[model samples]
Target chain A: MAIYGVALLAGCMMFGLIIGDLLGQVLGIEANLGGVGIAMLLLIFVTNVIHQWGKLPDSTSSGITFWNAMYIPIVVAMAASQNVAAAFSGGLVSLLAGVLAVVLGLALVPVIAGKPEPEQDCQDEPATAVASNTAGSRRG
Target chain B: MFESLIELFDEYHLIAAFAVIGLTMYLSNWLSVRFTNGKFHGSAIAILLGLLLAYIGGVVTGGENGLADLTLFSGLGLMGGGMLRDLAIIATAYGVRFSEIRKAGVHGVVALFAGVIVSFLAGGIIAVGFGYTDPVDITTVGAGTVTYIVGPVTGSTLGASSEIIALSIAAGLVKSILVMIVTPMTSRIIGLDNPRSAMIFGGLIGTTSGVAAGLAATDARLVPYGAMTATFYTGLGILLAPTALFLMVRAIA
Candidate 1:
């Protein structure tokens, strides 16, 4: 039943929140840390386990999808609720915060990805080719 | 009759909210398909539209809750509250495919943490650049660059002001849209043509919808791989941002 999916989600959320609260206490932070994230992890693990058992019926999967589809509306609602006018008038901080995020994130992609395996075979030829080209250009 | 109709809308304001949002989505999606040819996702457009409406709502009412300040749209306050927002975020985990993650291997895993750290630090640095000295404000905005959800979640936890939280969300939304638009264009340059690369990309990018849509445009086959790691990225972001990352920011700033 679809309700089963919701029940599972709710259970995971509760468990995650409790654990998060405990973790917060241990860390001496007054706020809950990672409760929503922990809950999502629990749900993923639980759903995968159920799928492995072959007990995850279509009904249950659909149940999850039904709510998952609500992602768009929820996000839109959130945007609607945000006070961007106030944020904008506050300063250039928000715009800078966003622009820097994308630029810095894209710059680090190559650094994080390193070298792809298949490209290694062809790497030597391009390396020498580019090296010679650059050397010739510098001399000219 | 008019009074009764108004009463009905008030009583069923939640439903009214759904109707209004539904209409907005329809219009946004229509514009997306008709004009942008789906290069931009409908949801992104809808979000932009929502932000615009919110600005107008705030200007019209001079109140704090944006569109929720309006009597007709008051239900948006509850609909957009932390409860439903978290629920929507948690629901995303339900769609994850476990087998797909194994293909990305070690780099995929590393990318997830790296993506979160880099994105968090980028946000934090910019927060500092803007003269925000409080660790709570800095951390919250930094987390927002990770993902919109992470921003508000971290913000509320740290007791950041509403203005800061809103900025954090905006920062995230901008990052998400940029990823969605830029990924496809840079695919060839970055070698994002393969599933493994896509996974790594997702891990580095960290926004699920953005990575998913971006991968979808680049290569439909790679969506699952990219989205799988991206999903984990959000979870990891939530876990690290508020606790470890926040502490680091607190120490540094």
Candidate 2:
């Protein structure tokens, strides 16, 4: 049932947070080492397995979708509580950080974006003509 | 009875923060719907409000933790802790399908690396300019350009000062807001109409909130495509910022 999938999702989330905490402890970072992201990956893999074997119910899939949609809004809401105080009071140092980022980001745009068409090796300009010729030759 | 009620509020100040945040969300959404025509999502506005509230709380109380410094709002410290943040991020994965990520291909992958490295360098250079000679501070700021999430992680790992870490987060936040505001305006010039283009854009920009919001405004259909790579961008940034990137920065500056 869909309820089972939701329960499984909760379990995965809890498990991920624990692992993330443990990872942070080991890494000595004092943060949650991408715990949510790991959990999401786990859920994606588990759900796929469930779907592949013809076991996942529509209800469960919907439940997953519902939670997925809520994730962003919740994340955005949570981000408001971030340490803006530090950023604001950090003074000219932080100001330079944003300025430099924008300058460098704009400069790199040309090199890093939308050049895949040049890398396309094959040219299939006349797909219809080639297909028609092949068909006619075969029939003849 | 009134004194007891006040005590109860002091005990559950977190609930007050929640109430305030919830109301802030509603007001933000209404403002978005009315003025910007939903161009700016409620999430962004809510953040603004929350920050304003925190600033007010800090000014009023002259406390260290902003609203958390107030006895009636201490819950915010825990509520805004890593636990909920991590949980929310995990939920974001539910919507993602791995196959979609694969469709971005080699170019998207390249963009991810380029995005992170270039952003990091930009940030590091600024940190250096600001007299932050320490590698930890430089690397943290540099990583901040990659994404907000990477900044704190790198800072904590390298033992950067709290102020520098905050600066990094600010740097990332500014990048995200800029990307969000600029993406829709430049979408046509950037050819961000297709799924592939969106993927590359996401990779290059690497701020999930900004990418998603910008894409939503530009073309709702492309949000998922863009956010996928953006999410991966965060993961990669986290992996690289403290270890490989930190070493590279140390060698250079």
Candidate 3:
């Protein structure tokens, strides 16, 4: 059953990579497109479909849960392989790109999120609640 | 006997590498709980430690592959290679439920698109600011801002040089680490207490590990919701980065 889960995952990965490769070729690019991400979508689709048919046994689902936690170690392996020195030596461009992306993204959070929900405690105090509500909506 | 044991480790370097990483994770988790009171997830610390080790490895070995350059740790290269990375990414999808994602509704969808475009523009504009004229290079770095995985995927597909690819990866790594560190601190201010907000946050952030760890630190219950959208962000980035986005960058700069 565990192997079945991995087998399913592997199958999805294969198809994903194939699609990625084809997409690259069609676009005249030399590298695979979002193979890993496609594989994830496939996995989600397959697993959802199967669950609809019947409940997947605990043992079967454990295979996936097992690998889910394994993501951390795998990512650590990735970090270990990265060339930090080379990137820093490359120029300030890399640093700037990274910092700017995150900063701008974080700033946009409020804009995308719009107004915050009214606090529960504010409801208890009628007078203060009106003032805070107005202030919150105005800021939003 | 000792020499043969050493040879065995060399031959099974991947296993040795796993052991080392396991130890690092354990220690990171311990540190997170003991010192940071779990406000910082173990994974972030582990990555920082990994990066530190990599820097030290590069300094010591003076080779391109970092710690893997040393024969004993050579397995780190393959362990960290594409095959496993892809597998890890896929495996993360196993537990995500579509029902929860649907609950995020239109806001979630909008957040995903907005997140990717904003990140791409930021990266591309910054790349331009830095004097990277080639559209391919600009797109690749921009894609990296989407996520480290997206960067290399975009870079290689667009025929970016190895140096540019490395920079993309670095840019992504920096973003991931920053998200992990900043999330908990900003959670209250951002009101990231609910699953809906977390999903939007994940979509906006667009880094699976970063969002997952950050949410884990802020509120463990929000992880799956956030992670699901974050996963989609990567897929969307992959689809756009090498195709439409690249073309737009070319036209602009």
Candidate 4:
């Protein structure tokens, strides 16, 4: 399940990249390929943050912290190290455009994958209260 | 064809970095689950491991003048060193309730974007003050960009596994170098708290800006790789701020 989730997320990123590239070309913006990647990453990060924050789980928070502290820097470093001269000389814009297109192609996966609905709050309180009452009764 | 494949594998260090980071994270998580019963707090472990691996790999593959040479390693080391510096800054900021400076709702997002922008502007000013020219106008994807684009394209064009891996790794390393140089200064200037600062610093080194800046610095032969570092710092600010801001807004909303 975890592996599947990762693959799904990766697929979504690819799709998002594609959509972002097309959007960039339509808008005629430079570096839109990156823009798309940023957008996808942001979407994933924020959505995860929000979803997990709602749960207030320690594990999730730890995951978020790990991501913020470690993953972001790694991604930034990777992007920065490219040979910009060759990228430009070889029409990096178009190539990025193509990469973006590939990313966008994968966008449909999420729609089909179906995001889980946010958990309800009321489901747990009654059970907890009952358990506490039982413990109190036993103590009495 | 074989030579090209070998060269491609030798170049793109980002893939290797990613692999290292991923593996490190996996191992850390595995250890946490085993020892702490799933209570491992995130810290410098994974990043340090990734850096060590990249350094070792570079040394093994490129030898003395290879991508992991003295200058590049030192630059990367300095860049990583900044993370420790930011950890102190973050501790201080939290000590003073600095996170409260922004509205509670959007503080994290604001902090992240501000950090990136501040770092970029500061890094740029620093670069210009230090007499570094912007190597490639982002307005057009130039030679630098082509190496990344072409590396993948060439691999795909040639349909060779070695070429693909080499190009990816070369691309990654060059990117990492650039990010390392610029991100610390930018993050420091932006006044982000510890975790965000660390992440932004990492991100700056992770992208094409790192490679671009590194190569530009190398070409200009000014302070070895100063230009590349500056470019990575500034480019990150340019590239990431908007999305960060947007995410913050959404988070608050």
Candidate topping TM-score: 3
- Candidate 1 chain A TM is 0.69
CAPRI verdict (incorrect, acceptable, medium, high) for model 3: acceptable
lDDT values of the candidates? 0.72, 0.66, 0.74, 0.32
TM-score of each candidate structure, all chains considered together = 0.67, 0.68, 0.73, 0.32
How far residue A35's Cα lies from its native spot in candidate 4, in Å, is: 6.1
lDDT of 2: 0.66
Worst 10-residue lDDT window for candidate 3 chain B reads B96-105
Tens-digit lDDT track for model 4 on B1-253? 9767445544644344345346556775576577767543212233334444455545455442222333323233323332322221121111111111111213223333343433323322332333434321111111112223223332333243553334333432333443334333232243222222222222223233342222222211111112112222323332433334224323432
TM-score of chain B of each: 0.65, 0.65, 0.72, 0.29
Is candidate 1 or 2 superior in DockQ? 1
The clash count of every prediction, one per candidate, is: 0, 3, 0, 76
> iRMS values in order, in angstroms?
8.5, 7.7, 5.8, 17.3
Residue B129, candidate 3: how far off, in angstroms? 4.5
- Arrange candidates, best lDDT first: 3, 1, 2, 4
**lDDT tens digits, residues A15-102, model 3?**
9889977876785655565565567667888888888898777788777777766766776776676665654554577677767877
lDDT digits (tens) for residues B137-222 of candidate 2 = 88998988778789998888789888777778878876765665566667777667665666677777877766755665465556
Q: Whose DockQ is greatest here?
A: 3
Better of 3 and 4 by TM-score: 3
* Candidate 1 chain B lDDT trough over 10 residues, lowest sum: B95-104
Evaluated against the true chain A, what TM-score does chain A of model 4 have?
0.31
